[model samples]
Target: MNRTLVRLLQAPSIILLLLWMIIPLSMTIYFSTIRYNLLYPERSGFIGLDNYRFFWTDPSFFPALTNTLVLVGSVLLITVVLGLAISILIDRPFKGRGIARVMLISPFFIMPTVSALVWKNMLMDPNNGLFAAFANALGMQPIEWLQDMPLFSIIIMVSWQWTPFAILIFMTSLQSQDKEQQEAATLDGAGFWSQFYNLTLPHLARPISIVILIQMIFHLAVFAEIFVTTSGGPGVQSTNLTYLIYIQSQQAFDVGVASAGGVFAIILANIVAIFLIRAVGKTLTV
Candidate 1:
């Protein structure tokens, strides 16, 4: 009776979760098979795969896919490398380490919109932005970071916001390190680099993989920061697949095309996720 009651109580929550998840996705799939444009309402007709073909044939499509891959790869690389270094540095007991950790992690707490806006107006501005001013002061050419390198600018912004999460994860992983092992290595005159490569890094392999998988999943859908900073470009330069979908849905007001693009994105993300899971099973598992 008790088991039955527990199952009965959970039924509502499960049904609600399914509804929340399925409705929008179902709508998108249905719409993708139709030619539904808000602008061309009178031309409604069944155009199975036509929307998909149109999106795939777009000049911006391939570049958007490449940009997403580059962004995810670069951000994850920066986060892991920098995160490992800082985690190790701060793992050693030091004065004011608590306060420093808080400062470092605080950037991750800032809203992406706010972060991007401040970066655009306050930092990346060519005329009076902090970055340009500093370069000018050093007798270097003030770079128009966003205008010249829109995609790169967004990558830097994302890395700044996310690297701290990686640091925290690595620091937590480091806490479980066996100090006796380090002492034994020291006795054998194995310097810090040798110890880290053979001992610490091997232990960190799992959390490092976890960080990469998790960061890649989140970064694949990075939209707000890119939207706020670049508005998808001076051209299509900064438009990732997500932004391309946004342009289709909103600017172009083509629901069918947007849904088709979204379906493609879903497939791409799922493919990456499946590969990561397989990697974990093959390499990380016992």
Candidate 2:
């Protein structure tokens, strides 16, 4: 009777979760198969795989895919490496460490739109931004970040926002590390680099994998920073798969093609997620 009651109480949440996920996914799949356009709703009909074919064959498709891969990869590398280093540095006690940690983690809470806008106007602006002022002070011409280096700028903004999350995870993981192992290594004259390589790194392996898995999932769908900063402009140089879908649905008003793109994105995310989960499983088990 107790077990039955527990399940009965959980049933509502489980059903709600299923509906929350299934409804939009069903709608997207349904629309992806039909010839639907907001401009010509009357001409909508069963088109089958035509939308998928068109989206696949689109001129911007490959570039968008490549950009998506590059953005995700670059951001992951930056955040993980920097976060690891920062976390290790701050793991030791220091003056003002509490205040420093609070400041570091604060960026992760900022909304993506706000972060992009701040980066675009306050830092990356060619004429009056902080970077430009610093460049002028150093007797160098300020580079147009959003215009000339759109993808890189987006990567920087995203990395800044996400590095804090990685830091938090790594720091928490470090707290649970075996101090006896470190003491033994220290007594054996294990230098800083040696200890890090042999002890700290192995302990951190799981946390690093966890960070990568979570960040990979989020970064794969990164759109707001790009949309706010570059709008995927300068001739699709910064366009990723997610932004490409937005262009299709919002700018082109092709619901079917956008839905097809959405399906592709979902497939890609699932593939990456599966691979990461398997890799993490191997690491954890070993």
The global C-alpha lDDT for each of the candidates, from Candidate 1 onward, is 0.92, 0.94
**For candidate 1, lDDT tens digit of each residue in 1-286?**
6999999999999999999879988989889999899999997889999999999999999989899999999999999999999999988888998999998888899999999999998999999899999999999999999999999999999999999999988989999999899999999999999999999999999889888888988899999998898888878888999999999999999999999999998888887798678767886656
- Measured with C-alpha atoms, the lDDT of residue 175 in candidate 2 is 93
The local distance difference test score of model 1 is: 0.92
Q: Tell me the deviation in Å of residue 133 in model 2.
A: 0.6
Q: Mind giving the per-residue lDDT tens digits that candidate 2 earns over 60-139?
A: 99999999999999999999999999999999888999999999999999999999999999999999899999999999
- In the predicted model 1, the residue pairs found to clash are none
Q: For each candidate, C-alpha RMSD in Å?
A: 2.6, 2.4
At residue 236, candidate 2 shows an lDDT of 97
